[model samples]
Target: MPRENSFSDSEGRSLTPDPEDEIHYEEPAAEAASPTYSIRTPWSPTGHTVPHPFSASRRSLHSRAPHPIPGWQNLTPKEKFRITVRRVMAMHRGASILTTGGRVGAEPGVDPRRASADALYSHISQDCVIEVVDYSAVRSSFGRMTNKEFVNFMGDKSASQREPWVKVRWINIGGMSWDVIKAVSIKYNLHPLALEDVFHGHKQNRSKADYYSRHLFLRILCHELGDPDYSPSGHSAAQGSTLTGEPRSMSPEPMRDEDRLNGVKGGDVDEEKTMYGTPPTSRQSTTKRRRNPLLPTNRRDVDGMPKASNSASNLARLLKREGDVKDARKERQVEEVSIEALKQGERVNVKVSPMFLFLFRDGTVISIHPEPDLDFTVPITQRLRSRDTVLRTSADPSLLVHALLDLIVDRSLQVIDEYHTKINKFERRILLKPKMRTVRELHILSGDLILHKRTLEPIKTLIYGLRRYDVDRCAALIDMSDPANANTKVVGFMSHKSKIYLADVFDHMEYILTSLDMFTSISENLIDYTFNLASYEMNEVMRRLTLATIIFLPLTLLTGYFGMNFEAMWSVQNNSDWLFWKIAIPLMIFIIPVFMYSDLTRVFHFIQKKMVTKQAVKQYKRA
Candidate 1:
């Protein structure tokens, strides 16, 4: 037996060790065993208890009881799935850590759990201490412990139930229900609109918020199973109420030519009798009336005569009519079956469908469907195969979202490329067209100009998105310096090759702006040219008019002179045809005066030019 150090307490005798002495310890006997506390291990599958750190004799050292690990209880299935996915990703990315040490108490002035969740995540990641807590054991412990005992066990301020340092990454709820979503929204302080958008089946593109926050939301389009023929059946009927257009009934069968003909023929009937009652049948009704044997063999005879020949003809006609009716019914059934089969076959052909959504941190969204993939690697390569598989395996909404964002960025670049191609084609068209000459020619240029303006908006939108969201790409596009001329090796490497590939885009934009400017200038110049040409043409017309007026003025004077029929002139005119010669001679004499007047006009213009030249000289001298 080893020597034991014992001390006497006030209530009873107890063994204690001297602080300065070293003593050998022996195991307690079966009848006198040391007391112990039990703690549930964190990783145990079953709620197994292990001895506490401090023994019963040293229990007074710690006053707090062990607290259980936290678990989610009121979350939806979808939310649970999302949380699980996020946790796995965080772990894979080395962005999170698990820990079991209880939260630290608030220091003199430091706030407990001072950092945000993200900040805490970073800190824990640096330490690389993530502990997996055994939630089942903790739950069992709670059941066994009393409320007062549990409270005392939890400990003080920093160790309170609301310890912020102890973070839970993933939780699971029973299922995805409206109530669960509401509860989650309350717990997480999520936006109502964000919650609404998650449930809404609209495939909108990526939306963004002004800043990154704990409550970021995103929307994505996903393929869901649904009935192929599901449609708004009652909408058409409801639309009929306020309609001022022609009233029509919903009919499965399309109207045939024969049906239209029948309707037209039926329209000729006197509607009054049809609306009123079939004018009470004139023939008396008799239950025992005889039937005509001439109708068919199946028909009874009016008088007891056979009438074999007439009966045969009526039977043939009846048989023919029956055969026609049967054929029509068969044709209708065939058509209906064909139509149903065709509708059923009309599924969303993945090969031809473009399905993608751009996701953003905020809830704004843009969805696009590009042309079918032309690859043989997989059957549905274009339907986001990579992202879809990741989503299926991990059920991680964030990873899926990131994948979609990557796709969206790729699409944005593709769209930019396409736009550049279009712009290049448009520019080539402008360059190919003849230069503006006449108003008619300018009008053609104007038409092309209008097209350029119309296309500019979409290009601007693409550019805006690129500049704001794709800074690197935009910067690369703008790098026009020569690689050989670059001073730094990095810059030289970046600039080594001329952005000839980007030339199409740059040249296209350049040509568009240049062409637009040229077109506008040409248009303005053409207008001015047109005005000048019109003015010159008008001046020429005025000159011609003046010449004609001057020539006619002399002829008119001669005619007036001759027309003044005095008595002497009248006697002379009667004497000889020489009187006509007299008027002609006078008109010929006036031609000299007209020539003189034309010369005088030329002299006047010369004088005006001289006066203008003198004024210009005077102004030049003053300057």
Candidate 2:
């Protein structure tokens, strides 16, 4: 018989090692292990080993080595910089310094200690700095650092003082709240509006600058906080309390009108009388139980004492008052609960991701990443895989601080594009219906039509800024152009490609504007038509009513004349029954003959004249 054990092997089989086998398993001595070393290949072939001619000579040997991860080849210059910065920063373990701001410094004589260090440093090196600033002392020291002082601190002191590129990563965490914005603003001299936007977490695709400065206002569309899989209950409780007047923890008291009206009848009156010796004075009893003014005569007094009802009317009134009290209590409770719920629900945390924006810099602005970089990546491939790729360029603090006003213009373009896409789709669907009721239908269509109109002008302004930037860059590149150089060909091709893309965007925008105009005109016309039709309908109704009144006027007049006393006419001396018929018959005969002869003669003469006129007109015209 073998003893049972709780332990199991890797395969889930119960392990019962023999005592003899267990004793054989000994720990190896650490000193017995061999040291590891990297092997170095010999430059020349060893005499002991025969070298085959098929294999290249050791000294001259060559084999394809896996290519160094294709650096900056498949990536844009910006992307390459991003990747390089990230890789460089990840290598550092200790605290690091980052300078962020413009590419230039303030003029000389400006306090050296009061200038933006990053800007000054960039001026010296002609390189953009994306380093991490020391944040440990940020909270305490930030307030003391002025804009100029900060710049000076970051200014280049010497070649030795130059810092390598430090990667600044864009984090898409639960968006920057007010606290984050304030902290960032203190550290970076950000505009209040820019900070507010970040704190509020309203992200757009572009960035903007504040008036008269390079301080950027960036919109970063970020996801709202909380679970996406939420469902609202369809039944909203009406804003009122429960039907019970009692507190939630307490049971409702049963309403008893009869009990209240009995006035403590059939209960220990003799005991109460004995305690008082003589019947307690009415004044004492009334003092102990004061009646509610609003209650009926038969209602209970304030100490829960019953009151006597003199008549059935009093009892009925008491019951009605009790019912009213109950209803009031219920309504109050409902209202209180509803108010509490609304207060709790007022501030909802919405989850958002980056979209488009209007970014601002100084007077100049250009579209930064006009189209979303759907293929942007982060260091952690797995995290990147789960996240959206198009980060609002506004999320880049560097861009926000450096970019100019035209940021909003770029975002406006994006807004226009979105608005146009939606409008076009809507228009196409509406146009499918022929003979639409123009006004009502057009009004309904206009709901989504002018949605982004307000955003358009601002966007156009930004576009202008971008155009200026583009022109400047183009001019600079042309100045650097060497017609005979192969590189010029590459640059030219890139310029051409950029123009093509710009043209495409412009063409699409033009189409949208044209479509909007056409739809607007059509809608206006439809509205006019609708009003006209309504007016026409009203006129027709009025005309018909007038004609009806005219047709009935004679009949109404005849009825009125007949209704009056015509006894004098009827009682004419020696008037016979035949006399009435004689007068009416002759009048009818005369009227009918005259009407018939007039109609027949007019018709015959008109036909004869029409024939004569046709013949004479034709002859005269021919002659």
Candidate 2 wrongly placed segments (more than 4 Å): 1-174, 179-451, 469-500, 517-521, 570-623
lDDT of 2 at 321: 65
Candidate 2 lDDT, tens digit per residue, 1-623? 22231112224322222223222123223211101001111122112211111111111013233223323254456544544443333222100111111112211211111111111111111011111221111110111232222222322134113123312222211221111222233323444344223322222223232331333233432222223232111112332211222222222233223322233445422212311122222211110111111222122322223343233334344456667867997898689667545433212222223332222222112111111222211222222123242112122322321222222224334434444454454455445542343334456545434433322323433433443354443344443455654354211111223343344444444554566566666556555655676678799999678656654554555455545765566534456556545555665555545545765698899999999999999999999
Model 2 superposed RMSD (Cα): 33.7
- In order, how many clashes per candidate? 14, 56
True-structure lDDT of candidate 2: 0.31
What's the TM-score of each model vs. the native?
0.25, 0.31
